[model samples]
Every structure is written in structure tokens, then in C-alpha cells.
Target chain A: MTILLHQNLERAAQALPEQTAFVCGRDRLTWRQLDEQSTAFAVALQHAGVTPGDHVAICADLSLPAVIAIYGCLKAGAVYVPVDHSSSDQRLCALIEECDATVLVITALSLNTRHTLETHAPSLRLVVSGENQPEQRSRLEVVCFSGFLAASGRDPFVRPATTPRQPAYVIFTSGSTGRPKGIVHTHQSAGQYAELTATAYRLSSADMVAGVCPLHFDMSTFALFASVHAAARTVLIPAPVLRFPASFALQLEQHRVSVLYCVPYLLIQLLERGVLDQRLLDSLRWIVFAGETFPLRSLQDLRSRLCHVAFSNAYGPAETNVCCVRHFVPWQECAEPDRSEIPIGRPWGDGLCRVVDADDVVVEPGEAGELLVSSGTVMSHYLGHSADDQPTFCFCPATGRRFYRTGDVVRQNADGELVFVGRQDRQVKVRGHRVELDAVENAMTRFPGVLEASVSCVPADGSQQLHAVYTSVDRQALDAPLQRWLQSELPRWAVPSVIQRVPTFARTTSGKIDHRRQGQQMAAELTTHNKKES
Target chain B: MIDQSSFSRTEATRQILQFLHEELLNGSGPVTLQADTDLLASGTVDSLGVMRLVAFLEAAFAVTIAHEDVTMENFLNASAIAALICERQEGAL
Candidate 1:
């Protein structure tokens, strides 16, 4: 029984040992090599005092070694926590401390942050460097990855017995409370997600999947777990290559990538700037977009261009790993001309979905309500929260199941497909990553000079961008320092693009800052400014 | 015709590095960037940074960089960017 996530890697290695499993730039790891290295690394982790249920943080870019470290953590029965290596030192330290990670697998790019981690994360004892052995200066024991793996014998490490309910991994997402919340997924939940994704896409060993999203993003699960489940080759697109659309498209063509699961933002970039007319991308068979809504016009344009490729819209929050998917039939889309937004489709596999009103009563067909999902793919719970403390899940009396509140308002169309209306909360998707407006506002207020902050999401270039209007005494002097502070506190996607200093904010009748009016005024000003520039 | 004598390769490379350090990086980039520094692989430049660099290059060097020209070959390093600028200027002339 392949209950654990790493079992897929072992099975793939046994079936297709010599096949290329992962490719990143010039580095490629065969299935056998990946399996063997991961097994050895698992033993190494055990020797380094990593016990079952311990959190192992991996602060590295998506590379062959990082992938191996992830599987190694899983094999060792330790929950793997992937941290964005590009994030500021402060954010990295906060995540490390929050997760109470005992061991850190870091790459050379982020090696300098070890000093900060040593001071901030007291639970961290061992540091496994992906590069050459750095001189140990801190209390944490540092070991080179190559040396550590070599010390462990060439034999496979004996697997530890673990229940399906045990935590497999923890993915941190933007929390409305200003702290990034860790969403804990059990072995059963993650494994089910991998199995469902492979089955849904009909992924095979012949398919070359493009791993475009970073490891920290939930969308990366499609590239990591799904590809492993089907024994498919995953080409990890480098961060730099992802920046240039032409280069990104070239990678797709060069690798003959058949399946690509990414956000709408990247697809829009490829359509506008990728110069796809010059490249032959017939190898692309399926393109699945999730995390945010794709603009219909851009989607239509892309469909027109890649007539052979199938497009799917996947829907689910991080709490539920892609419970629903809509595969667009080219003819059907053409038949329905008036359809403005793509439906999120029906629940897949054993997943159950309910749309309910404020009273928790199920809404009638075609009525808009908050989406509730119950499935094997649903996460166990947040890391710091107990089952009782979590307000995200509610019990459904009819199904006798706990359903996760998605906070997304959706309405059922005539075809029985759920169409996304809008977010019921202050959370918005920026470049497909969730950003809570309240969180950004809170971070801005943390700055010494800022008195009040209000953040708004504005649609720009097919994706959403954050804009902040704040009241500060030192308006001119605060701009650079405030930006620097926010960049250090939050992820790049969460940072506001425009920060305007306002004398006073528009207030509601209750004396609370009216965010809607402020947002409208900003949007109006932006539109007028853009028109004048053009 | 553009005056080729006004700008040398070294001067162009210096200006590219300066722009990268001041504008794209916002003083958060590496302390020193060599001519052969691998910008893309090192995570020195991101996607949005590349767009800004392209615009800066076009406006500063008086060269129009096509969309297809923004590949790793030309933008991989300061030297490569300078070379692309010189090539564009020569092509225009």
C-alpha cells in the first residue's frame, strides 16, 4: 500500500530505474539515483538526530538536491517544510522559528542567513549545506550535503512505520492575522492529492512535466508529487529563465514538456511577451492553471494559438489540494459565447463540495454561497492550531464529514459547474499567491512612522497588484525606509506596488477607515494617470 | 548614424552594472558584479527586473531590443548586455 508520498519515488525507481526523473538546468537525476540518494540522505538525517514527526526546513531553490532533501525528509518520517529562499532574512527566520524545525537544508544562495537563523530559531540544531562545507562559526552543526550522503552507506535506509494520519509536510500561506500560517498535510492527504492529479491528467512516463512554480507555492505539488506518481520527468525551470518569457517558452520546447501546471500570470506573460509565434510548442499537451482566475480573453487567445493543447482550470485552497478541476472542451467553449468566467468544475474523485449561506444551510442550485470542500486531499489542520481551535472547518450533518470553508463565493451554473464569484474575505491572489490585505496593512503599521495603513487589490495586466495608502507624519522620508521594511517583513508578492501618503483616510459612518472608498479613489486616479501617459 | 566613438564596450558594461545595482537591485544586489557574473543563474535579476533592465538599456543606449532578443544569451551578464547594445547600435547604423 503506497500510503506515504516517498513510496511513489521508490516504486518509480523500481519500474524505471534508468529514466531521467528530474531535470534542472544542466543537472539531471535518474530515478534510481534520486531514490538511492534520498534513501542515503534519510539515513543521514537519522544520524543527525532527526526523529519522526520532527520538522525539517528546506531553504533552497527548486533543484535536484532540494527535491532529494524533500523525499529524504519524508522517508525519515520528518515533515518537510519548504521555505522561499528568495525571501528576506527576517521572514525566513520567522518561518523557521514558527515551525520549530530541528534541521535546515539550505543552499549556497541562502547560506549567509544561517547566522540570523542561529539566533532566531532556537530549535534548529543541524544545518545541511547543499554547497561546499562552510566553516562552522555558530552553535549549529554544519555539514556538507555530499559529505553527509557519502557517510551513509550505499544501501537503502529502512523505512520507519508511520500512520496515514501523521503529518507529511507543512506549507505556509499568507495569514490574515499578520503571521504566515502553516497548513499541515498528512501522508494520506498529500498522497491522495498526488494520486488524483496523476489520474486526472492521465500523466504517463512519456510526459515531461514543467515545474514552473517555486517549491513553496502549493501549485508546485502538481509538478513534484503528480510527476513522481506517474513516473514522469519534471523539468525545474530556473528562476531566471522564468523571468524571461522567451527563455521560459524555449525551455518548454527544448525539454518537449507535455504537461505544464502554472498560474494565469505566467501564461499571460507567455502570450504577451514569450514570442511564441517564433517557437514550436506542439509538444505541450495539457496546461493546467490554478490559484487564481485566468482572464477569459487571454485564455481564449491562448486556446486559439495552441489548438492541440487541452486547458484545465483547477480550484482549491491550500487547505484542500485541488479538489476540483474543469477540463475545457474547445468546441464547448466556442459553443458558449456569452460565458465570461470559466467554471471551477465539479468535485473530482471522492471529494464532496457544498455551497452554504451564513446560517450554514445549503444554498439552492445557481445561488451564490461560500464553497465548502470535504475530501481525502484536505489538510489535517494548521500546524499551531488543534482540531478544536481551527475555525476553518465545519461539520456537515448530512454527509457526517468535516468540510473546509474555502472563503470563496461561487454559484452553480445551469451545467452544474461551480463558477467563482469573488472572495468573501479580504484575501486576494497576487501573481497566484494568496495575500491578505489585512496582513499587508498590519505590516505597514508596524513601521515606526506609520499611523494607519489600508491596502487594496487592483486588477492590472490580467493579474492583481497590491496598492497601499497610508497616513504618516514623515511622508517623504518614509517611502524608501518603509518599502525596505515591508520587503524584509513580507514576501515579494505581498509587497504593495504603489505606496501613497494620504493626509487622512475616508471613514465610514462608524468612524472605521472605509477601505472600499479609498480603493475606488486610488483606482480612479490610476486610470486617469494611465490614460494621460498613453 | 549613431556615433560609435562616443561609447566604448567597457563604458557600456560599467553603465549596465551601475543601472543593475542602483535601479533593478535597489542597492540590495551583490557588492561587486563582474563582467562575467551569471546574473540569471545567481538570482541577481528576477522577471520584473529583466523588463526594467530592457527598458533601461533601450532608453540609455538608444537601441530597440526586440522581444525575442531578451534571452539568456544576451542578458546573462553585464558583458553580454553591453555586447547586445553594441550589436544593436551597429545594426541600426
Candidate 2:
């Protein structure tokens, strides 16, 4: 019972050596091929001086090489930190520095990124995984994918000494105080969640899983690890295709994908577009949605359309990959009447869920309170956090177990299922990515001439849209320059839809930024502006 | 080809640029949306941003972009996006 994540890949390769392991676009790799290539890549990483406990940054899209790089980094006993390949070079460089990455595994698609990193983090070793090789650059050691594989030779398997307690990965998420918080997870903890996911989804070797989420997202763990654990074939849908439901549905049909893991926003987009039809999704058996709350109407519409497919709504913070899962039973089967909202379900695996009051006392069942999760899957700590900022986990003297405050509002129903209320903090999900409204505002204030700023997620055309309102001394500075600056500082999704300039931001009685009242004022302003144009 | 003249590259670029400036770029930056502005490579619009842009184009141009049409090569920049719209409009007409 080895808990190392790569051991599953090794066993799967040994058992089903010729089985199709991964399909990225037109490229397909067998279990043995993936194992051999990753082993070779791991050997190359060691030869290139990546030691155990070293951080390897993987900044690439959903490609075959990206998958191999993840496994290779794990096999090499290094932490695999995935950053979005589409991020600005500045953002990518920030993450690379924040994670203290010594090696970066990137693809040919991001050649510009390689150059940027070379200029910024000059000491980094770059391994290019694509068709064409990049030209030699000064102060940087570059290795071509084909050449590295060839040079490493066959069966040069070098498995560095690793322990279950060692950090396996570091995923950066939005922080309330402005900076991106890196959540570190140990090998055992991450592997525990992966195994739990595979069993919970009832995945098997015959299942073809469609990974719609990006590697940078926490949900992509199923795409990378659970499939390998189950010896199931994982298919990564391209970023562009994911936008078009008709195209995504066609891919599902063509591949006979059995399990789908994506955010509810995507599902809602597909349903809203009216392109998610039966023929396109005839092969799908399980529809797993997470990262945000699922709208009731969208869920009902999907269940009505795909009656045979099972719908499972998952809930958890990036701290604990996925702690709670609620399977939607049919309306007729439930004892209680159907409600407008969906319950986040009971805790999965060894997770313990509790709703606590302000005094840290557990609330009575059916009462709304802040949810806390106690599990082995909780993140080790926030990267680079001081002793005061660390310890999101609290030890329960009564139970002698650690509990991480989820900061999510939830309540248990009569059936003992935890129903999601709203977020207790200013954090909101923009297309499944966690965003701290204050962080966006912080970035906004940093722009020259900006006096004060606030951001809110407003409902627009049946979708959550980010709207920003700011007061600036220089009215001219409220436009394009501010946006370009925010775009550089934040991810693309964090960029506000409409950035408006105001004389002053409304405040609360306590003189704090009255987010709720400001949101209403901004909504009214937008309506008035719309009316004037019409 | 009958409606190709109906969708001029300059007009298409102007409208798309306006949409990017307002909806995507928030009209606060020094972003110059030229014909060759490399939207995909420069991260001007991400994958999610592209989806919103597609919806905007489909509505503004009255041209239905197929699922296959949402590629980085086809929607890479103002010129490529306008070219896609004109080609689709011509075919539709």
C-alpha cells in the first residue's frame, strides 16, 4: 500500500501497459508510453539538477506533454506547480518566483513565455515540450523535448527519495488581503483525495474521462490523478472548444467520454446556448460539477434533458480539494419537497463537516453557520505566510483533530445534508475561479490617479459578471490604462466587465466600504447609463 | 460572396475593438487593437474571454460562429476575427 502518487502510474502501466492512457487533441499515449516517457523525463530532471523537494513549474495548456510533465515531476520527487499557460508573462513570472521554482516545463505554444522567464528568472532551467526547439539563449539552460527523451536513453528510471509527508504540489488561489495564496498539499494528502475521487465517481479502466478544467485549477486533480489511479483514459478538451458547447458535445460523442468534470458555469453556458443535446452526450454517464454553486434551474434543465446521467455537485475550497459531494436524487425519491437550492451533501471519505457559530461552538442541525472541514486533505499551509497568517487549521481539543475553517455559509437540512448558503467573505467565483473582490480593488487602487475602488459580482443575463466601480482624481486614468494594469496584475477572469469612475465610493456606518450598498448604487448607475444610451 | 461587402474589415475591426475595449479590456489600458494585435499570444482575451467575445460577435454581426470556428488561429486578432465574420456572413447570405 504505497501512498506515493506515481506508484499508481507505475502499477497501471504494469497492468495495462498498452491501454490508452491519455488523449490530447489528435495525440494519444498508452499507459506504458506515458510511464516510460515520464520516467525518462524524471531521469532528465535529476540529471539537470532537480533534486527532491525542488519545485518544478508546469506552465502549459491541456496537452499531452503537460500531462507527462506532471507525472514526471512527481516521479522525480519534485513538487509540480501548474500555472495557466495563457497568463501574461508578468503574472507567470510572479508565480514562478512565489513558488521558488528551479525548473520550468513549458510547451512550444508558449515560446514567448520562455523568453520572458529567461529574462526575469535567469537561473531557471527550461524544458521545452513541443515539436520545434527554441534557439539557445544566454543565462538559461534549455532542453528540447525530443532531444531530452533521446539523450536520457531507455529505462533510465531515477526515482528520487520521497516521503508521503513531502509536499506534492502548490496551487495558487486568490487571497483576501491582495496577494495570491499558494496552497501546499502533501503526497499522502493529495493521493488520499485522488483515491477518494476515483471511488466516489465509480471510475474504472473502461471509463474515458473528459477533463475540461485547466491544470492550474484544483478540480484538474481528477484529470491528472484520479484517471491514472483508476487506469482510466483521460481526454483533455481544448480551451477554445470548451467555449462552444456544440463543439464540446461533439468531442464527448466522438470519444465516448463517460465522466465529465467541469464547473457549473460551463454547464449553464451550454444549456443557455441550447446546444447540449442528447446525441452529443449519449455516452456520458456521470456529470460532475464543482468550483461553484449550481443554479437550480440549470440543474433541473440538465436532469430533465439527460435523465439517465447522474449529477453530482461537489463543494470544497482549494484548501481541501473536495470535501463534500451531494448527489442529486430525483424529486420523486426524496422525502422532503424539492428546494430552490442544492445541498453540498455530506462529507466524503474521512472528512468531518461541522457548522460552527462565532464562538466556535457547533451549531444545531438545520441552522446556518460557518462550515469547517476536518480531513487529511487539508492544505499543509499557505506558502510564504508568516506564523500569524498561517494556521488556517485549528486543533479541536475535544477530538484532538485539525479543522480548517471553510469560510462558507452552510446549513444541514432535515435529511442531514449540508445545503450551501452564500460565501461569508467577499470571495466570489468568476467562471469557477475564486476571486477576492478586495484583491481586485487593491490592484485597482495601485493604478495611478485611483483614489478608491470596489468590485462586486453582479448577475447579468443569467450569469455572474464582475463589475468594478472606482473613484479617481484624474478621470482620464479610469479607462484603458487601469484595465491594462489590472490585466497584468490579475488573471484574465479577474478583469472586471465594466470599470466605472465615480466622484466618491459610498461607505457604511462604520466608514468601511459598503460593498452591498455600493453594489446597488453601481447597478442603478449602470441602468441609468443604459437608459441614456437607448 | 454577396454579403462580403456588407461586412467590411475596417468596420468589423472597429466594432470588435470597441467590444474588447468596453467588455473585455474595460477601456482603461493603452491597448491598441490593430489588425495584427495578436490577441491570443498576448493574452488580451483568455479562453473564457473568447467565449464572451464570440457571443458578442454572433449577436453584433448576426453571424453564427460554429464550434469549430473558435480556434486561436481563426480568432487570433482583429484581422482574423473580422475575416472569420466576413467569411461566415458571406456564406450565410
Candidate 3:
């Protein structure tokens, strides 16, 4: 499969010669067309001295040609690093320098961030699309994806040779201090994850997926890579559609999209907008939501709203492409409060899950502990400066095998289902009392029509106080129902002192709920309101 | 837009106040309305504010702030803020 990541297109192009593999805004490309276009781009990249294992940085949003560039690098035996097109210039340049990439492929949308990179990164090479700034283009060797496609690659396809140990792709996730962390993956490891996961989802070429998430996000990797490897068609949703719910749903139906992969926020918005109906989504299957835990109320709203499709929970970090997933079969069955709770479910495809305490001792069943995952899907580690480059091996102490430390706090129920506790750092100590924010969130989600809820502890005057942010299908109308529900079940301290609802929660690149912003908003709102009254 | 008052762009303290008044604009927050004294590191101004202030000075002075301009000398308190803006504006004009 490592060999095929570069060479797989060769066989796929042969087997499905004229079959449509990708559709971009009324333009459909067959396997033959995709293969030819990508090969031509790779040959151009190779000619520009992008040799085997050379890092090729991609600076573009989701598009057919951009997608081709990602795989083309691998095909030409080089690793691809994707930078978020919307990221700040300072942030983008930091990542480019850290990856030490010598070549960059960019689109018109990504050109603004280039003002900081042009004169710097002396070894950087370029391939531009749409329009070129000739003065800027001369700073680096620039060629367009279209221009490259028109160029000749006369020879038949010869797959570039790369060892299993070779670098495949580098995705930069957010750092604690707003810096970027470069997460590197190998073709051998990412391929195993992609293939097994495709089988788990029962994907085939018959499917046409709507690619909503950016390639820069790890959660989007499943859609981007899996569809290519499984020979399914994909359409990049336009930016406007991505921002608004109704437009996004309309685009899916208009494109005849059969698979939907997005964050819970996007899914919740689709349900709120109610653009999807039986006719619109009949062909759609395998709706995977990850990036953050789903509010049970929103999950139920989706089940009741769209009763036909399959909804699945996808859980993982950039370190491992995908670690675990569970099907929300008979999703209506899970609509009941006790039925579909926040169980991240078990590990995916031969992966092992362990709940261990601070002492590294496996906790008794149902006890909360940090989750340690050991799997073939485990990451090698952070690049060059990594103190330990060796992968964290998943081990069963009883059986004596190495394992991966997931750093996730999880507990196994009697049925061996894993329920995510909040992060280890978020555990609350109030008057030396322990509180799980998820527990508070669980109680609040029970409120009728309350789609999502996030709880955080922040200093009010001197000590920490519980604060909750939520959204309802009915806007601020759900406030009364939420207050009624929490009044019955929660203690005074446990109940969020302030429940602020928003149009949407600010999410990080990987899709985790951004509590820091909520906390800031809380402080800002308090000061604003207090001053207004005074 | 800033409500202009009689102040020298060369004075570090006044320039800091101008940068704060421009970037923050007293938008429904008491903290912004309260003090112009300790704007830096008071959580009143953040990393984003620093970036915007740099850009604001570039247009206000018509001068380029180098990548090396991120040091505390140009960024500490309002005095530092005013000093950087004034230095750039004085030379720029």
C-alpha cells in the first residue's frame, strides 16, 4: 500500500479508466484525466528539483488541483506539508521554516500570506495558479497546475520508489500559545489507517462525498485521503456554502453528494437550517462527525430530523489519523437520552484502548483515567527536535506488548464502551471538590432542544467559577428550559452561573471547542454589562 | 476614528494612549474606559492588539516596522507604544 500511495493511481486509473473519479463545479474528471494531470504536475515538481522525500508545502484551500498536488508529491516520492490558507502570515511562515520546506504550491486565495514568505526561505520553490505576480514569480520558479497539465509527460507512468520509512505528509495543528505544531505522518502508517477505516465505513467508488473540512485539519484527512484511496468522487464545497448552513446543504444536493463528513457544529447548523430532506439526502450514507464531542440533544435533533442516514462518531488526533469510530445505527434508537450519550466508543481496527491512573496502573472498570492508545496508527513523534523519535508503542502489560499513549482521559463502562471525560487539566477543584465539566454539560444537554453546551471554569473575582455556553434551535428561547432542567438536577456550584448562547462556538483547526474564547467572552460580557448597569 | 487632542507624537506616553484609544475604541467594556495608564500586559491589550498596533503605525507614519520590531522596547507599556509610534512618525514625515 505504501508503494501504491504513489503507484495506486496507476492501477486505479487502469481499472476505472473512463469512470468519473472527481467532480469540481460541473467539471468531472475521470481516473485517466486525474492520473495524467497529477503525473504532469509531479514531473514538473521533479524537474524543479523536488526529489524523493523532499518536503513540498501546499498553500491552498480545497480544490481539485490542490488535492492533486497533495497526492502528486507522494506520487513523485516527496512528503507534502499543508498550511491553512486562512492562517496569519507570521504563523504560516513559522510552520514553513519549521518544516524546512524548499518548495511551495499555492493558489490565488493563499497568495496574500505569501507577502511574508517571498524574500525569505531562500530555497523555497513555487508553483502558482490562477494568476501570477511576475515580479514575485521570479523570486521562485513558478508554474500553474493548469500550465503543468498542458506540459508533456511523454513516458508511460513509472511509480516513484520510496521506502516505508519515508515521510508521507506533515499537517500542522494549533499550538498552546497559538504557535503551530508540525504533525508528521508516514505513507505506510497513514495508508494502514486509511484502508482499514474505509472498510469500517463500507466505502466504495459508488459514493460521491462533499469535502467540507480543509486539508489542513486532521479530521478532514479521512475524507481527503480515504476518498482518493477508495476511488470515490469528491466535490469541494464553495466557501460561502461552508459558512452558511442552507447554502452548504443545497450544494450537497446539487452535487449529488453521497457521503458527508464534517464537524458537529456544521452538522448542527444543517439540522437547524433544515435544508436536507429524504429526497435531498437519500443517497447519503456514512455521516461521520468528529473534532469535538457531540451534544446529545443535537445528535437527537439530527436523528429525528434525518431518520434515513447513518451517523457515526469519528475520534482521533493528528498524531494518529483515526483512532476510534462507532456507528449510530438506528440513530433514532440513540435519540433517547440514555441511549446515545458521549461515548467515543472503542478503538478502531486492531487498536487497543487503556485507562490508566497517574501511577500507570490500569483503573478498575468504570473508573476515570487518562487513556493510552497503542496501535499501528500511532505517530512517530514531533520532527527533528523530538527528544524521542521512536513511536509510542501500544502495550498490554498483562500480555507485554508496546502501546501508544493517547493522553485522552477515558473510562470503560461495563459494556467496554469508552466515555470521554474532559481533558485532565480541565478537572475542577472547588473547595477541594472534584467536578467533571462533561457531567455539567450532560445535565444541561438534557434541556429540550438545546443542541450544544460547553462548560469551563474561570476566575470570577478571586477563585474559579463554572461558566456554560450553549446554543439552541430556538435561540435564547431555550434559556428558560435549560434553567428549569439544571435547577432540578444540579447543585448551586455545579450549575453554570452564566449561560451564554452564541450563533456558533469558535473552534480550533482540529474542531475542539475553544473554551478560551468563551472564557474571554464571559469576562468581556461581565465587564460590559456591569458597566452598562453602573 | 480617534478624537484628536493636543499632544506631541514624540512623547512616548501620549502615543501609547493614542494607539490604545484607536485599537480598542472603548467598545462596551469598563476596562477600556477605566485606565490609559497600564494598557500593556493588563490583558486589556493582547497579542492581536500588538499586531494591529504595528500595522496602524505603519499607515500612520508611512514607515515599515521590521520583523525585528517585536521586542519589548517597542512594545512594553504605553510609553513604549508611544515611543515606537512617535519615533517612526517623526522620522517618517
Candidate 4:
């Protein structure tokens, strides 16, 4: 009796066939329609030679078709890999090759992306989702969405038999080696996460959930799968709409979204832009925040404004599906400004969470150490890489349970709650996207004239920004070319916010790059620049 | 009530092209940017580029472009962005 993820969709369609499932702009779909369309899509994938355990790649903006593609791949028992629509051709090709993807579903809105796929990944089949198909030239066959759907019969297609232990999907994350690492999660892990999330949020079919995250981001699981598990309707907010806080707040009101999962950076932006108001967000009950640490001052402001909404801070890596969660009573937390740190709180379910010192021994209460978490929701392994290559896991002989080293420094408070301190590694969250400072520096060093590059995250206006300090003796005019090179090589988010030219980098007593002092100096310079502008 | 003299398409295009050359692409690059260059289609302007362009427009034109106005249709090129700026300035008038 294995619990499958697609079974959630089947059960919801059986119970509430006419209920609204997903809403993106004016487009809406009922459970019955979603179930049927996904089944038809699965049949179409099968017709296109997508067999069980095949890898299907989806690169599109947040839309109905993208949702359908995700479920269809799952229903067909294939691992779905979602990349951002804005990914460069090189990165996308690398991902396709990395996963050995057989079929790629794209939107006509992205003609450049479609062309790139056709040009680069010739062996892979392309399923165009929108109109305005260009004249085909590649050896691969291209099928328009309407044509592809029409090619398959309307009969309900049964999903292939799969156990919970099988791999469900692979999500790519930033690697320290300047290459993206694919983390594979089993069906049981993802299903348990969705179920646990639904129960934690107390979601019901009556709740309207707001999807504020991109499909490639791990936090989006709550918006998509968790909503399905609870039979709740999810309303996806487009990226452009996210820029306009007023319109986004209006959408929340119009859609009557009761549950929301978002990063603290976005919450701060909405508050700063004056888009968050009591009346506009009156329907919101649960507001979950993750991906990055929320500044205590901003959290206080948000809590004070929206006293009725429950604020929960969740802590986990992409490897672990949200192991710990802390629910905050807005009124209670806002009253005490002395609460400088927000506790990530206790573990969800029976998951084990421990704070260990450098010696791997359990730390004393209130002593900082690396946080280790292990549960049924931990990722299976990194794809194409052996456990020894990048060992984020350890098998403890005493406990007889494998544990993931989260690399996050934390301590248990007096109340037996985990309080996040900082990261022991260079991994930092830039606008909720995981970025490795070393990885950015690695890309920076590849430039023709770069002698040495030191990249670090600096605190700016309550958010983290990557700032680079480089010394290039050969390249006199290095600013613009270096920027262009970085833009072409790395994703936009991974690019540095500000790059400074220096004759030489400061070194510590051990002759290592002094990133700490560099970060401090960069922050000070940015502050002075801000003052001068004012 | 409206002074329409400041909103010139040619002037907007000149400024936008200059900014793109200086900021996004190096001043001297293989890709020749034009007024009608498709920013979204060519992948010249991505999400971060859009944000930087919005900041530039707000500072240069002394106008505010709302988030909804930052779509691909509006920021696809110098011409579209210039048109959006003109429209916003006219609305302000």
C-alpha cells in the first residue's frame, strides 16, 4: 500500500471533480479537467516514446501548461526536471545533457529558448506549448501543444506501477564547483513533505493558496503538491506581477488566498512598497517564510501590520524537505524587540535534528554547532555523482541512521528550539536563491585578465548581495568586459551586484584571502555611496 | 496641461541605446543594438536587466513605472520601453 503523489490528484478529482484546482490569471482548471488533461498528456508523452523512468524536462514560465507537464511526467512514471524559462541556452543544454532528458516541453512565448533547444539538443524531442511555431529545421520532431493533445486519445491513461521508494524528480542546485548539482528525491520523500505540509498548515479544500515561487525553487512544492494533497486551489503569481506590489496584493484579495508560502525578501519588498495592507491581505491566515533568514526588525514590522496572520519560519536545505518549523504569534513576537534571533523551532514529525560540534559530538544547549537533519524526506543522492564525491551525508554507526550535514550553524535555546546562527560554509541566499560565493569567484577567475577574484555576500539595505573584489593587472579596462563575461556565463542572480577593482586583495596571517574584511569594506563603501546619493 | 515636447521617441531611443551599450553590453561588442532590438527575444534584457532599466528610466525621465508595466511587451526594446515611458509621462500630465 504505497502512497503515490498522483493519487492525490486522483482522489481530489474523485471527491471534488468540479472544484477549482489551479488559477493563473484568467485561466482556471477544475480537478476533473486537470486529471483528464494530465492523463491525456501522459498518453501523449507515451506516444512520443517517453517510457517509464524516462527524464522529461520542462522549461516554461508559471502557467497551466507547465503545471500539466509536471503532473503528466509524474503520471507517466518519469522524473521531471524543471528549469527556469530565463536560463541561457548553454545552461539549459548542460542540464539536458546532465539529466539525459529525452523530451523537453517549452512555450512558444520563448522562441529564443525553443530555437536554442532545437539547435543544441537535437536528439531530444520538443513539445511546444504556445502558438507562433517557427519553421522547423532540426532533425528532432516538434509537436505543437494542440496538435500533441489531439494526437492522443481522450481515454483515461493509467499511471505505471511505482513504489514510494522510486525517484520522483531531480532538482538542480548551485554547486561549489561552478556546476549545477542535481538532487534526486524519491516519491516517498516528496509525498511525505506534501502531506506533512498540508497537515502543518491545516489546509483544507476551502483554502485558496497563493503560489509565489518559481517551479525550479524548492519552496514551490508547498504551493503545488501540498495544495493538491489538501485538495486546495492554488493561484500562481507571475514573475512580472511580483514586481508590482499593489497589483500582487490586489490579486491576493481578488483570489481570496488564505494560505501563502513566500520568501522573506519578497515580504520585505511588498512592505517597503506599501503593497501590504490589512484590508488587502485580510483573507490570508497562514504565511510561511523560508529560503533565507528574515531580519528581526522587518519581521516585527510585518507582524505589527498583519496581527491576525500566523507567521511561520521553516528551516531546511533542498536535500531535506523542511525539517523544522516555528509558528509565531505576530502580537507576541512584535512586543519584544529584544528577541534578536528567531528560532527555527522544533522538528516536524519524527525527523531527527541535532546540533553537533566540530568533533561530531552533541553540543551543549545554547552552544553553536552545525545542524544535522535526517528523515524520510532527505534526498536520495546527487545524480551522476558518487556519495564520496560530495558527501553531505554520514552513516552514524551508533544511531544506525544516515544523517545529512546541513552546514548551518545553530543552537538549541532554553525552550528546546533550534535557533539559526549562520552558515559554516560560503553558501548564502540571495533573494531566496542559493548562491555559492566560491562558485561566483570561480566564474570570475575564468575571465581573460582576472588575476585573483574574491567574491562574498555583503549586507545591503536589509538584503544580501554578492560583491566581488578582483585584481587584474593585464586587463586595464576590466569593468564592462568582466560584467559581460559574468552575465554570459552565470545566471543573472548569480552575478555580482557590485564589482570593484583593486590592485591587490587583503590577506590574512595564514596568507589566505580575507573575505571577512573584504565583505566589511564593501558594505561600508556601499553605505557611503548610498549616503552620497541622498 | 501637458508639455509633450520632452517625450520624443528618437531622444528616448538614443538614451536607451547608450545605456544598454554602457551598462549591459560592453560599449564595443559584436552585437549591434538598435532601437527596435527585441530585448526579450534576443535575451538582451533579463530579469535583472529589467530591474536595472527600470531604475534608469525612473532616474532619467523623472517618472515611475509600476511593476505591471515591466512586462516583456513593454520592455522588449528601446522602442517599447520608450513608448512605455511616454505613456507614463502622458498619464502623469
Q: Which candidate is the best by lDDT?
A: 1
Model 4 gets an lDDT of: 0.78
Per-residue lDDT tens digits for candidate 4, residues A341-433, read 678999997699888988789888898888988788888888886543335787777877888899988889988999876667777889999
- List pairs with backbone clashes in candidate 4: none
Residue A155, candidate 1: Cα error in Å is: 6.5
Error of 2 at A241 (Å): 1.5
Residues A1-534, model 3: lDDT tens digits = 344464556667888889887776677778888787788777777766678878887877777787678767887888888887666677666777888787777766245455567755655666456444444435655666677656635645455777766778888767765666677777766777778767877778888877788778876666666777788777886443354355567677777777888888778767765355523666776688887778877787677777767788888766877777777874555544465366788888778777899777889999989877766666656666352433333446587756666667888777788888766666886655778787788787777767778887766667777878886665666766677678788876687777777655656654457776766777777778768988
Worst 10 contiguous positions by lDDT, candidate 3 chain A: A385-394
Chain A TM-score of model 3 comes to 0.91
Question: If ranked by TM-score, best first, what sequence of candidates would result?
Answer: 1, 3, 4, 2
What is the number of backbone collisions in each predicted candidate, taken in the order shown?
A: 0, 7, 13, 0
Off by over 4 Å in 3: A1-3, A109-112, A135-138, A151-159, A331-337, A385-401, A509-512, A527-534, B1-93
Candidate with top DockQ is 1
TM-score (chain A only) of candidate 2: 0.79
For candidate 1, lDDT tens digit of each residue in A373-420? 989999999888875454688887766798898888888999999988
lDDT of 1 at A39: 89
Question: Could you list the iRMS of every candidate?
Answer: 5.4, 6.6, 17.9, 6.9
Comparing 2 with 3 on DockQ, the higher-scoring candidate is 2
| Residue range A287-384, candidate 2, lDDT tens digits | 89887655555567667777778889888998899999988653334433446457789999889998998788999988878898988777877787
List residue ranges in candidate 2 displaced over 4 A.
A109-116, A127-134, A330-337, A385-391, A427-534, B1-93
TM-score of chain B of each: 0.92, 0.87, 0.59, 0.86
Point out the higher-scoring one by DockQ: 1 or 2.
1
